[model samples]
Target chain A: MLEWIRFIFTAAFLAAGIFILIASVRGVYKFDYALNRMHAAAMGDTLGIFFVLIGLVFSAPDIWLGAKLVLIIVFLWIASPVGSHLIARLEVNTNPIWEKDVTAARRTIEEGDTHGHL
Target chain B: MSKRNSNWGNTLQGRFLRWMRFGWEPMDVLLIDKMSQDRDESVNDALSAAENLRDLQLSEKYNADTAIEHSIMQELDEWSLSKGRKIVNRLYALLSVTLCVTVILLLLETVIAMPMRGVAVSPTNNEVSQRYIEEGMEETGAVNIVAGMILDYRAFDTLGESTVLFIAACAVLILLRIDRDKDGRPTQELIAAEEDDRSHEPKSDRILQGSAMILTPVVLLFGIYVVLNGHLSPGGGFSGGAIIGAGLILYLNAFGFAKASRFFSYKTFALITLLSLSFYALAKAYSFYCGANGLPSGIPLGTPGSILSSGLILPLNICVGMVVACTMYIFYAMFRKGGI
Candidate 1:
């Protein structure tokens, strides 16, 4: 019974991960802008990897392998956001047509919007 | 001549096939009937058409002041020619990229869903796996069975893969490398390329540079470790080499081509790739010859699990790593700026 439960959990998680990844690809196909596609890509890079690896950890042959999977998740979570930031910066820099959509501000206070709490 | 040949178009079999294909062929039946009736007339029509073309060409040549026949190729102006080529290239790139991405996604899905490590009853764990697992350590003298299998057992295949990468790099070089004058000065095109980079590429972005400064050395060190420990770990030459190449790319992005060229240039890439490939070829050849002719591979297979245990696998791994690294870095350099 316990093994069956674990198997079900693993399957569910794996399915969810695959679904999210497919959704990410679909989003890329559907979205017009590069930045929007990158947003989808970043989701796949972070959350999809996280869910899949976590599922694999449940069925991992050994503790060391599970730990390694977790490490992979950690590394991706750290790096993916940074990578997305760099790619977005590149997109903004190279393509000047996005200027109208973008509003530049040096400080948070200068934007005249104060709704969020730290 | 027309009477000598049978009217094969209106034959029973042809009629049957045409009927089957079109279902109700009012047009085809009428056409075939007309064709069978007017065979000589059709030939005469074709000859007359040729004469008309010739007459048209003669008139164009004699009467027109312009050498170019605008009527035939009026659409292909200088601007349209270049623009059409660009559009075609872009379309080709888009199609290929989408195809590659779809294939990769499907393959990834398959691999991730499949059970990887252990199984009592499975197709993945066949005789091949058993052979590799049981006798791999004894024959190849490497802890990592995959590394042993790829490098020692199937060295020729890896050699071919390396050669493919080298050829690709060479092709890119031939296509994109900037030509220089006799005195080794930058040509006009090269100067234009320099100005292009100056205008577009990142000009010392602090965040990227700072992160790269902290990360590049560690990434390089990890790549070296992966390459050296190929026989003992999951990673081998190819993956390690790619990692090293990524690190080099990061370094190049952080500090421009000039900084990268201090240690690695076109000369460095050419030399490393040449020496490594030659060494790999010679070693593989020696192994193949000895194995084929029933002579012992004289090189001592040291104790397994140790880095130095695999006789030629380590050196072979290093050679592959060098070639792959050079090829990857040069590919990027050539694509970014025609020369390294």
Candidate 2:
């Protein structure tokens, strides 16, 4: 009974991770802007990976293996954010027409105010 | 006399007919002129009718010829499109069938040649392997038979493999290395282009730089540990060197070549690779000579489990590790810039 319960939990976690990763991939294709695609990819990199690794740890045969799995999570957590930040910076630097694709903060507020006034 | 008169009468009759037909009187002359004019007109009319019939025939024949030519051209076009497509499809199908047959035959040959698993007569139970299993540890002085085999028993092959990698790196360097002036300054145009490229690329993010700085030392330490402990553990020079090389690359990406060059320059890469490879060659040559001459190499095989043990294996692994790490870094540098 306990084994079956553990199996179910692991499967559920893995499935959820897979679903999130798939959704992120879809979002990447659906989003028009590079920044929005990056946002979707970062979610998969962090949350999807986390869930999958957590599930793997539960199914690991030994303590050392489980510890290594957790270490991978920690390393990715540190690495992915940095990677995402660099990519975002790259997108900002390289894209000359980024302003047209994404609205500026000041313009967004003014537009909202105009709408309210109307 | 009467006969003569009769002959004269016949002559007169002929004469009279001639007078009537060729009479040159005024009325007779007018009648001849009218008759000649009518005859000329009738002849002209007949000639014109024949000419018109010839023209109609020529036009009908031309129309039939053009229609036949057009139909033939359309048929040729249809043949080229549909018939040509069918021919191409047939050629491709034949090629695929040939390839599939050849592949299947090759696979079947391999399967037939393979020894049955678990049979005593299998290749795995051969005398050479039996000896290796029984005496490899003692002969090589390493607990890990796999490492001992690679570093000692088959060290020449490993050396060759390493040299292949070195040559590959050299080839890439030759093809892609940036040309510098006598003063070691990169060419002005190349520098200008690089500057333009860098302007478009993002500068290092603070978070990325910070994380890389923190992780760099740890990663390097781990790589060293793996390299040093290769003989006694699961990890070896290849994996360890790859890790260290990756860490170095990550640092370079975060901080850029200017910062990374302080520690690892093109000169440094060249020197390390040259020294390590030379040392490895000399060491292996000495061991091979000793082994061939049935003489001990005089290098002590210290206690197997200790870091300093395994005679030449530890040093060899470190040399391999250095070569690998430098090669990886040089490869990355060459890809990024034309040179390190």
Candidate 3:
């Protein structure tokens, strides 16, 4: 029963990993802008790795292995978000879409404020 | 035409007629050919002039003068380097800097390595132990031995660590803090701009905002738990502080910098930092004067397995946690919108 549980957990994690990889590729191809692609990649990095870690925890043979797995999960959790934020900041600074037309209603409000204040 | 050519060719006249048709002949035919050749030469000259004018126009349009000037400057630079006294000065400067750097580096390496050479490990409770015995386990009802050690055993260190955090916060604030002219008071213009920007954003994205809202509480609770139980577990000041910092980062990322700033202001942060540092220093001083001639008397190491076992670890942990959380948030805020 334990072996079956481990096998199922492994399969599920592998499937999730594959799914995230596909989604990341699709997102890269489909996204209109670099920022949008980055968002997709960040999501894949955090969620995909999380699923894989959970699977590792379940598959580990002993408590020590499980604890070590948890350490990896923790380390990744801390590092991943910071890495994503840095990348996003770099992208925004270097390749800002200044000429692109704003579609969000918030932009109109901002424009109104700028003109009205002056 | 054949009869006329045959009669003419019988003598010089015939030879001249044949030469006039195919080669240079000295007579009226040669003069006519020379005039045509002069006209053709003038036409070719006109075409060449037109080509030169076209090239000049292109060069003017593209600002080729600037390119030529740049190349000329580069060549002059090469010439100067090859023939001038500046090269010798530069070489001397390079040699001096290299020697200075090598000497400085060697001195630094020796200084840094001196402490590690043939060192003796002496067990002295430098502030940490003193605080642990005096304030940590006794004051805070925490069990884990290490936690007790952190919270009570070295409460002062926790305080100093927190002060370090407070200093970091102040540094970040000073570094990133933008000067604003609000109502003639020096305020951050960037903060005003950020505020204006945030106000323009819509509040209708319930799904996105709601998840962040939910996560904030959960993460905060976990952070507090880590801080509270620091004396009893592996997680202490640094870890708890980092966790709280992470929580703040998450909140800021989801809700934006302006909203996060509302919860903590520069004045409040400054006050907290000052208070934490003073509290830590005062506590240490009190312990030093009241205790055995500034020497730490080991606290009664209580039942080893109990929550209150390590005397001062718990309080120290709390202090460290607070300072770490505040510093981390300050750093994040400064990095995000406040000019770093």
Candidate 4:
């Protein structure tokens, strides 16, 4: 019963992770702007990775292996956000017509708008 | 307008032609807006943005105006005679494809030539390999046979590989390293303040800096552990050093080069790499001498599986780890900016 439960959990998490990864890739292609593409990529970097690692931990043969997988997840969780933030900042700074592509949320903040396109 | 069309025509090829034909340059929006303002101003704006006519005339850096005209004429000549160039490019592409196919075929042929299949007693499973498996622990005093072979039996080859890495770093320094004066002093340009480029930085994201500060020590500690315990387990100097190097890179990225370079400058990189490489060479040379002479080096191999058991392997691993870590960090630093 315990083994069956573990199998089910692992399978569910793995499937969810794969689904998220496929969605992220599709979103990357569908998005028009670099920032929008980055948003999609960042989801894969965080949540897709999180679910896959969780599934691996569930299926891990030993406690030490599970712990190592958890450590990897922790490290990625810290690193991925910083990487995404840097890439987004680069895109914002370099793209001259960046202001023209502003969404409704960003367009409301007039003060925040000036610093971006210039 | 003729000049712009000529410029585009010179480099016309398959994909670029298709893209240009589809009107990919979104500068049309800006151009249309300029045209609406004034008919005459549209050409001027397009000329400035597309080709910078004024900047070209002011700078004699390319030589006299006639020389610039000469180059423009040469480009036009190439554009007019595009057919021959196109054929040459196609021939070059064909040659490249043929070369790639030949290489792949050779590699596959070699792979197919090998006949060893499944649990069959191949020549590799002979006395030489069996001897190493049986006596690896006793002779090398390392529980891990792979570690014993790499650090003891084939230590010389590993030494050579480490030297190769060191030489590669030197080569990169020669090619890409900039603004260093005689006696290897960093020029004022390299050592100058980052105040001018301050606007480019993301202004020390607190989350990144804080997490880096917390994680760096733990990562470094883990790297050290892996390097030291190489003989006992699977982890080794190369991997451990990479981990430590990554930790340092993360710290550098978060804090910026100004803070990071205070501790790890070009001088520090030079000192650590030189000391580690020299020590590695000397130690390996001594080990080789003893082995060739068939005399015991008097360095006792400690009991198997203990941290101290593998006499020279532990110290050698440390040397390699230091070199690898320094190399990794230096590569990052040099590539990111010319300095440090």
Candidate rank order under DockQ = 2, 4, 1, 3
Comparison by TM-score, 2 against 3, better one = 2
| TM-score winner between candidates 2 and 4 | 4
Q: Model 4 off-target regions past 4 Å?
A: A98-118, B1-82, B85-93, B119-121, B180-199, B291-294
- Candidate 2 C-alpha lDDT tens digits along B33-84: 6776778777888978999999999999999999999999999889879997
- The candidate that wins on TM-score is 4
Candidate 1 C-alpha lDDT tens digits along B182-226: 899989999998888876666566667867787788789889999
Which 10-residue window in model 3 chain B sums to the lowest lDDT? B199-208
- Stretches of candidate 3 above 4 Å error? A1-43, A60-101, A104-118, B1-160, B179-208, B256-262, B287-309
Residue lDDT tens for model 4, B311-331: 788888888898898888888
Tell me how far the alpha carbon of residue B303 in candidate 2 is from the true structure, in angstroms, after superposition: 2.7
CA shift at B195, candidate 3, in angstroms?
Answer: 6.5
- Chain B, per-candidate TM-score: 0.65, 0.70, 0.51, 0.68
Where is model 2 more than 4 Å wrong at Cα?
A1-15, A18-41, A88-92, A99-118, B1-101, B182-185, B292-294
List lDDT for all candidates, in order: 0.84, 0.82, 0.67, 0.80
Q: What's the number of clashes in each of the models? A: 0, 0, 31, 0
Ten residues in a row with the worst lDDT in model 2 chain B? B1-10
Q: TM-score for the first chain of model 1?
A: 0.81
Can you rank all candidates by lDDT, best first?
1, 2, 4, 3
What is each candidate's DockQ, to 2 decimals?
0.08, 0.32, 0.04, 0.17
Native contacts recovered by model 3: 0.00
Pick the DockQ winner: 2
